[model samples]
Every structure is written in structure tokens, then in C-alpha cells.
Target: MPAHAPARPLEIAAAGPLRGTVRVPGDKSISHRSLMFGALAIGRTTVDGLLEGEDVLATAAAMRAMGARIDRGDDGRWTIDGVGVGGLMQPEQALDMGNSGTSTRLLMGLLASHRLTATFVGDASLSKRPMGRVIEPLSAMGAEFTASPGGRLPLTMRGLVPAVPIEYTLPVASAQVKSAILLAGLNTPGITTVIEPVPTRDHSERMLAGFGAELTVEPSPAGRVIRIRGEAELKPQSIVVPGDPSSAAFWLVAASIVPGSDVTVLNVGMNPTRSGIVTALRLMGADIEALAEREVGGEPVADLRVRHAPLSGIEVPPDLAPSMIDEYPVLFVAAAFASGRTIARGAEELRVKESDRIAAMAAALSAIGARVEEVEDGMIIDGTGGDPLAGGATITTHLDHRIAMSLSVAAQHCRAPVTLDDAAPVATSYPGFFSTLDALAGVALK
Candidate 1:
């Protein structure tokens, strides 16, 4: 079967007085990593709170195709039987990654050092994304690729045993790219190093260490230097994935903008690298508080209570973009309800996501009767300033899960019901999004 999921459309209306507590799905990033790292580790890796989304499921399937035994039990925990390091078998067919860029790129890295060839395929959205960034680095490590034009997907990679280890600096701040190279380094001899000029999410580095890999991160004048020993063995781990901060972002923005809303999102991962949205919302004067701060599976966790607030926009710090890159669409929703203008810059990375998020958000905002200036890299939005938005319009999702969910949040403060061309993509990251939203907004879906 094709890994890409079919689409379903949705209509969102203004539901009054969003209240009570809800936990969003497990972190998408962590969920993908748990299966991947577990597949590389010997022994059984038990994962609790795995996001049962299409994207993460695709990763698990890819791992299975490569000889890892992964099973999701009736009790909701996942048990993975790894092939151990350097033990992956050549798959009989192309590995379909669906719409998950994290899966495509990271799997390429995992496949780079083995002595086998594998073909990768993705959905229409993922097929259009440039894979050249990954191909270039892996080629230097002696892996060979025959890819579509512009280095897009539907490509084949031939892994190189005893791949060369090099110290390379990243041209862009991408956790995916950084993680890809690090995973490739695991089976090479000696140390493989990646230099990050602007640090993105550090989940790979953190989780790699938790799986017993010898990895270290050090600060330098240039940036953060990460080194991982090669030909290493990974021990299995028992993991409890904290709720996704990115998924919590939609509600955070929703509760802050909608009148009379008091929402507490529980068990969210509070890793500094992934908490930029909360920081930006606080800066914009959103009444959001992080309560019961604690640690789980080596990452920070907390409960966030957000209340309706009159917000004023400010120029979002460019440096904060990497931390909350996935949360920008909803941040723009919050901006629509703020006073004055909110300008987000230095986020060119948004252009290469499942869609051109910069233009996508701009168009959706304009369709909902908000003023948005779409720039090459980011956007400038003028808030409705606590006034209800003129939202009797249908918005396009462009096969992006974030776009669908973000527009849904915008409907909370809209004067009329908002519709999405396709909300099914929400399953890529947050499958229970509509249901959770309905529960909080007091809307029943029949």
C-alpha cells in the first residue's frame, strides 16, 4: 500500500468558552526517533505514549521492512526487536516515507553505511521537497545516489560499508539534517562530527545518548560541535514520550485569543530547544503559565495553563525560529488576535516544509479577512486586536497538517465558521486534533 494517506475536509466554528484540561499526542519528533533508535539498538526497546499517527507509523513500517520487528500491543505500548548495528537486510521493495521529511532524511542516514541499496518514495508533498541537502553530505561519506531532478524523492541510495567520517558544518539550521548525519556516523569507523552554526532541535543527540551511544555536544565560538563515535552498539531503552509541544501550540494560541477560554495542556515536553512558542507567547503578553515542571525520559516536562488575554504583537526574535519552527502557523493565529503588528523573520526554513508555510499562512490569513504581508522568508501580520475575525471562508491546507490545525485555531475567534480544504493531514502529526479541539471547545462531532 502507498504510505501517503487520503485527505478529509473539515468545518470549524466558533465554540464558546474553551475550558478544562487535555493532553495532546506524543511528540512527533520523539515518536519517530523512538522507533528508529529502537530499531538500531539490540534487545527490546519498550516505548510508551507513541504517537499513532500516519507519519510515525510510516517510520515504524520502514524499520520493519529493514528486518526490525515492531509490534504495537493492545495496551498501547510498542515493543521493537532491533537488528542491531550493521545487521540490516536489503529490503525487497522501495521504502515509502509518506509526508514525513524526518523519516525520509533520517532513514537515508540510517541506510547510508550499510552494504545495501534501498529506494525511497514519499507522498506528493514530500516528493516535491528537495533531498539534495542530504544527498550531498551522504555522497561525501561514499554513499551513492540516483535521484529525481533537483534531488527530489523516488530515489535510490547505495550504502557504503566503512563510510568515511568527516567533520562538516551545516549551512542551515535543520534538526533533520543534523540528525541524518549523526545517524550515518553510527556505523562508520572513528568519530563523525557535525558543526551546527545555529542549533536546531537536539532530540537526536539527546536520544542517541539515552540509547547508550557515545555522543557529546560542546560549545565553541563558531557554534555547537557534536561528535559521535562510530561502529557503536546501542542498548535498548524504556521510553515514555512526553506530549508534543508543537501539538500544544494550537491550543495555546487558541486559548489565548478566544474570549473566556481557560485551558490547561498537560504533560508537554519543555525541552529548551522546543519551547520557543511558549517564550514568544509570554513575550506577547499571553497569560500562559508552566506548572508542575518535571523531567521524563531525560527531557523536561510540564503542564501549561493558558487563559484568554488581550495580546500586543512584537517583532518575533529571529533566533527563536529554530526552536519553534513548527509552531509558526499558530503563532500567526495568535498574532491575528494581538494588538499592532507581529513580524516573523529569519525563518527561510519554513519554505521547504510539507508546504511553503510562509505563503500558505499568508494566504489563509488573508482569506479569513486578516492583513498579512508575505515575505520571502517569513510574514508580517496585523492583528485584529481582540476583535472577531471575518472568517466565513474556506482555506487550503496544501497537504500540510500544521496548516489545517492552525486555521482551525483561528476559527475560535472568527465571526463565522471556518472551513479547511483538507483536515485529514492532521493525522500526520496529531490524529486526535479535531476530537481534542471539539472537547475543549464544547463541540460534538456526530
Candidate 2:
């Protein structure tokens, strides 16, 4: 949908016990990387369980624009015939990234050393996001960028053949930034190093190596040091993306708080860096158990079984911020129903996401009669001791999918129905969110 598409107002009321088993969509991070890496690999690559969300589709469209042959078969598997590393063709028009900051930033890195000039554009929300994090490192590697003011999107970037490689230390803990630097390094002639003060997701490193790139990771005094050698050849392989833990977060918190709710989410990705929500919820006394641990497409996988339980809020560790950064909104919703106050700090990164998640969640919670105090980095929430909240206000989602979905979960425990000004944003990452909620709750969310 276009950024200016009509607002999809949705209302949710308290439902009965939610009991069912379901599979969420594939991991958005992995889905994005699969298409990108597949596009740069030398042979045919097939992907199963690829997320068909708008954000992932944007990445697919961008890859197609750059001369990759991508098609979806009737069986739902996607096939990509790649042009190989350093073989990208210049896109004829500006790449419209929709709401996917991941696609925009990572593609910038991929294009950094390609000897081509491409333009990128996105929706209102994505255009507001700062792209300087990526532009800075790619620029340092000899790529030139003409971004909008404050280095936002709707920008043109010119890549350099024989790009200079440099060692860059991260100023913030961001997988997108780290991945951007590494993607740029793929087409450069020498080793490009990225020094991290804190570790984020390793999807890029893992997928890069899986696609036959020369990459190495080791411990350093600074943090984890990652080096990638450029001008490398890539070999395509079949990939099966696991269920997104981020998408499973809603049901995890929902089942924990709602009475008599017992739900199982299947095939959730359990990558250590991405499973902080489960750990944090368990810390708050959530009755969540991991069943059938296994490996899918080289990432840890498991089925999460969650049952209703009385939760007690605890001071969230600052170190866990990087791991569960995207899950904070739903975590805050979970905190609102716990037995005590939940304190979350060191998550200043939330301020720069699709929305200012801290502020957005704080306001939405307060409007629904939950006690919440907004802070510089995070929020402090006083729970209702598993009691239903007074939900009587219409929430402004600001076109953020997580916020919309989190509030929907909150509405399941509300005495009054909660209305969202725009539920369309949910399609960006989890298109079936409301329908799945319907299946579990056994009622139309309407």
C-alpha cells in the first residue's frame, strides 16, 4: 500500500481464552538477506518460507530492479537467478523501499562498491528515518551519497569500483548498520573490518559465509571484530527461513497475561541474539517453555509453548537491550499487566525506529489507563496485577506495525474496546496478525 493510503481503523475487545497452535511468518531479517544474498550469488537459489510482507517484498522488488531474476512458484517457494558478486546492473529508476529501512540501508552497502549510481525513495515514515548511519561508513569506503537533509532517504548514491576498504567502529549497536558495512565490503577489493562495542544480530555474517564469502569473526578488546574480504564469488544454496521470533512476541505476551490462554507458536527462530523477548518474559514469571529444539537454515529453531501465568515485573537488564530492541513495545504491553513496576533502560535505540516506540507506547498505554512514565531511553510501567485495563481511547499508531500489534494484544485484556487509527501498517511485517489473533481468540477482531 502507498504511504498515503487510507487509514485502516481497527477495534479490538476483550476475548475469551486463546488456545491454538499456529506458525507466524518467516523471519523478516532472514527473508531480506536471503533475497539479497541470492541476488548476488552465482547460481540459482531457492528459498522456502520467505516472508511475503510488504517490507520483504520491497527488498525483492529492489533486487529485481537491479537485474536479478526473482519469481515465486505456485508452491510458495521463491527462486532467484543471480548475476553474481559485482555483477549488479544499474537500476533504471529510483528504488522505492516502502517502509523497509533494512532494505534501504543494506542495499546502499551492497551498491557502495558496484560502480553504479542508484536512487532510493520510501514512504513518509521511512523517509523520516536517519540513513546517516549507513551513509557514513559507505562514504568512508569511497561511495558518494547525495541524501536528503539529515541524511534521510530519497537519495542518490554513486558507487566506486575499486572502493577503498576501511576499519570502522560502531557508534551504536545496530544490525542494519553493521550489515550495511559488511555488504559494502563484499564488492570492495580488500578486507573490510567492522569493530563492534556491542554485538547485534549475526545474520549477515552467517549468510555471507553460507554464500561462500571469506568472513571471519573473533574476540577483541573493543568487542567482536568482523572482517570480510571483498570481490568474492558467491554460490547459491537452498534456504528455509524460520518463523520470526519478533512476530511470535505478541502471542507470547498475550498468552502470559490473558486468563486461561494456552498457545503454542511453531518453528520460532531461537537465534541467541534475537530471543531476548522470551528470556525477558521468563524473567517476569511468564510460563513459556521451548519444545522441539532444532536447526533450520543454520539458525536455532523451536516451538514456544506459553500458558497464562501471573507475571511480576523486574528491572530489565541494559545488556539485553540490543537483543530484544524490536520487541520492546510488546514487552511494555506485557509489563503493564505484571504484578509490579517494570523498568527498561538502555533502549534509546527505540527512539529511531519506525516510530519513537518509547513515546508511542507510553502515550498509548496511558490513554488506556495504564500507569506509564516515559523516560529518555525507555519507560517505567506499573502493572495491574493481571487485571484488565480500562481501554477507551483510539490509539495513533504513527504507521508503526509493532505498536499497532502490541496495542491489539493489550486490547485482549481491556474492559473496553481499543481502536487503532491505522492498522494497515501491520501488513508491513505481519500481514496475517489480525487473522491469527482471530483464530486464537475464536472471534473476529474487527
- In order of appearance, the predictions have TM-scores of 0.98, 0.99
The local distance difference test score of each candidate is: 0.92, 0.94
Which candidate number has the best lDDT? 2
- lDDT for model 1 comes to 0.92
Stretches off by above 4 angstroms in model 2 are: 1-3
| Residue-by-residue lDDT tens digits, candidate 1, 261-371 | 999999999999999999999999999998999999999999999999999989999999999999999998999889999998988899999999999999999999999
Scanning candidate 2 in windows of ten residues, the lowest lDDT window is 1-10
